[model samples]
Target: MTNAGPDGRRIEEALTGGNMEPVVRIDDTVRRVAGPWTPAVHALLDTLVRGGVPEVPSPIGIDDQGREILTYLPGTVLDDVPPETRWSDSILQQTGGLLRRMHDASTSLIGGGRHVRTWRSASHEPVEVVCHNDFAPYNLLVTADRLSGVIDFDFASPGPRIRDLAYLAYRMAPFAEDALDDSGFTAGEREARLERLIAAYGVPFESSEVLRVGADRLLELADFTDARAVETGRTDLPEHAAMYRRDAVLLVGLSSPQH
Candidate 1:
């Protein structure tokens, strides 16, 4: 793995999120393999950075290798920290509040076009705001005492707030089969934890809506990825369809309004 580029910079292969989304580190910057739509996505990120939004890995520029350059944020992404991070109250609150701020900035920007390509959205969904579409623990960088930053802007697109919140709640609140490697809270505890996060994020929602969001997104994402894999002959998510179904059932079973 060599990263000898024009900057005379040596790059190191990063341990990706269990996928082949080749990422590399060069000093404090990250270089990611980019698609044609990356230019537009980078522009959106640039806007957020200029607005002084913290916790976002602001885009720097495109490298000569055509990889998108991003300022690598320093902190352990939540998945790395595991059970302790997930169980923290302040971590949840900060994550939710950061998301709210992101949505506020995104609503004023206009960037999605029909020609732009993204796995999360086939056509530009009508926007209440551009959603991070893949907001989750793995994408969130954190310290023991603070929420540091977010990485991976690849799945961002124009969509509803709940569409984003639902997924966030699902993964962050962890309404799934093996959340925190199955060492996490019970159903009753998770339900209460989710309420605290939503209240912290300040989104209005019926308990039913939150539950529905997480479950629906799990299946919807699986379908979208499977469709892409078949259409392009790319193996996007071979195991996830089944995993999504299982999680959807898990969520559906626990649709009770209270902990």
Candidate 2:
């Protein structure tokens, strides 16, 4: 599905015009739409303007038609299995550091404002940086086992750091039983992989911070999905939404402070 405008015009012209092969190359350009979400994305890129965010595409501007233009970021996106394993210690560490930096930079922009909170578990105290809410394998660009860049900032938002981290963990180390197979591993093997990932990212095992808030995040995702489905008049997503809600409850049940 292309990112189309409300009037359904293709707006990701710059990205499509480029012949450069991105990690996750999409022939169909993301059509831009003018709305609350698009401007929020623009605000995020604005925040990253001064900081040394490596290889980020430059935003052109909001078009008269209300579409946003951005330079196409380059790198290889490792979407699944064999590619997913390409995620190395350096990449995880870099990603962790990048996230930290983004959070630090975001403090100034959204430090004290009534902003929209995407996750219900998120504290409404003050907004942190604009999180690439969908930071995952598909959105990341990798080269030689290191994170080269990121793409798809459509879900960017001002929110808590933990919310972004939890979303990453949820995507990377999902609660689904089949995720192991998708990653080309057995259940026991996948567990080991997850342990290594957490270690590589320096996520404290004893903290229980990610686990404590996981259920709420999942519920929030479910609610968001349900709302989107309704808005788009699509009934196909409710089953998956229900599954996520159930999985979130299961995850909460499995949580332990002992790590």
- Identify the candidate with maximal lDDT: 1
- N/CA/C clash count, model 1: 0
TM-score of predicted model 2? 0.71
Error of 1 at 193 (Å): 1.2
Compose the digit string of candidate 1's lDDT tens values, residues 213-247. 77878888778767766776775364666778888
lDDT of each: 0.74, 0.58
Candidates' RMSD to native: 4.0, 6.7
Q: Which number leads on TM-score?
A: 1
Pairs that collide in candidate 1 are none
> Can you write out model 2's per-residue Cα lDDT over 43-84, one digit (the tens) per residue?
666667666675355566765656665655656665632534
**TM-score, every prediction:** 0.84, 0.71
